[model samples]
Target: MSVNLNNKKESWYMFKIGLVIAFSAVLAACSGGNGTKNGEALLTYGNEAPTLTQNPKQLDLLIFGGTAGVGLETVKLALARGHKVTSVSRRPERMTLEHDNLNNVKGDFVKSESYASFIEDKDAIISAIGVDASSEKITIYSEGMKNVLKAIGSNSSTQVVTITGIGAGDSKGHGGFFYDRIVNPFLLKEDYADKTRQEAILRSSQSRWTIVRPGFLTDEISETRYRVLLDMDGVQSGDISRADVSHFLLAVVEQGAYINETVFLSN
Candidate 1:
């Protein structure tokens, strides 16, 4: 009878051990099957590669008189927007703005070859050149513009965007008595006459172009708000800050919305 009892006890112990083993196997399977043993941990055991997006191509731009007051700031803004820029100026040494894609070249506007190399591979050109209004200055505003345009047209498929006065060319007499009678007769007759001829040159060029006619330019800060006059109407009749004018020049280039069109901007 004692022998029988020992056999029964051994059988019971084996059963208990088997049960424990099965329980452990179940726990292991459950831990591996679920994302986490509990609800607190994340499972990254078989994560695959992440999806990627393609980046768009960037445009290249060239600036004439880029070191000038408003033009300098325009360069900074263009660089910030990821556009590659080449700045050509009489005093190229004054360009202190640093950017990986910006190039500064020195040249004379009247000599096409001087700026020919710089505009060779450029996509577009912004002529921010300004001449002094002194009566003794023979290279009036229009003459300077003509020289710069001639240089820009020398090479590559570069489009041009340039700024001239509001009462320039056919845009004259737009500001009523203030611009026609009072302003142009005294302060701007010589300048306006030259700008008129300049506009004619730009219009007749084979290269794509835009002539920006702005009224009574000032060094004041911009409100970022202005109007665009497609026709001659409402032009030569309003005021715009130089900052805003530069902004418009760069903005129009990027958008390509105003191609082969003449825009007159004002407030």
Candidate 2:
């Protein structure tokens, strides 16, 4: 049988197109297709989190203390990713990044009424609350988180990601010898104490919570390989960029990963 050259080329082209479509369908499913789940439009494949998500579901996110270090970084990245982000702070005007999906709202996390109005409609709330390490007694981490939990009463669907430092919780003695003995004791003693209280609040709260403990945060860009340790066995504080932490936070909320668990991040 003699094959027609033009007809043969057409058949091959059609076969290639079919393969492309099949590959794309599987990729879409694995990459979290443009869909919703679990009443809040989350991407759910399995309990384990995917590191790289290509097509993330657009989320309604309320960032309590969104003007803070990690919170501010998350707001910028979330807006860039086209998610509807409500960046809350006492001075929201300080966040000059404007986007169609961005909503700058005046809110003080210390008061429930100040930010409760905004939490009702959010899919997740990232409490990037932090306080300076000082000799003075610190209670903002605990107090503010208490107000946050109150605002999100009975809303377990609203995934809450709270940022605490490495010296908090079981990661206490992991901030390096000098840092754990000197810096943490003399400087961050009060701050870490409050952060411990804050973690307790979230763990006992009604909201689905994931507590994130980032190691020794720095303004320097992260050029090293990122490390995420769900089990902090023998882990110590390492330098990680705020930028990388923001990326990790966004992933947690979007993928609905790490509920009821404490995660450690470093780079």
Which candidate leads the pack in TM-score?
Answer: 2
Where is the poorest 10-residue window by lDDT in model 2?
33-42
| Per-prediction TM-score | 0.69, 0.78
TM-score of 2: 0.78
259: Cα error in model 2, Å: 0.8
Model 1 C-alpha lDDT versus the unseen true structure: 0.65
Q: List the residue pairs that clash in candidate 1.
A: none
Instruction: Give the per-residue lDDT of model 2 (tens digit) for 39-113.
Output: 222222213323647878899999876876888889988887779998888888778687898889997778878
Q: Which regions in candidate 1 have their CA more than 4 angstroms from the true location? A: 1-57, 136-156, 234-236
In model 2, the Cα lDDT at residue 106 comes to 91
Clash pairs, model 2 backbone:
none
lDDT of 2: 0.75
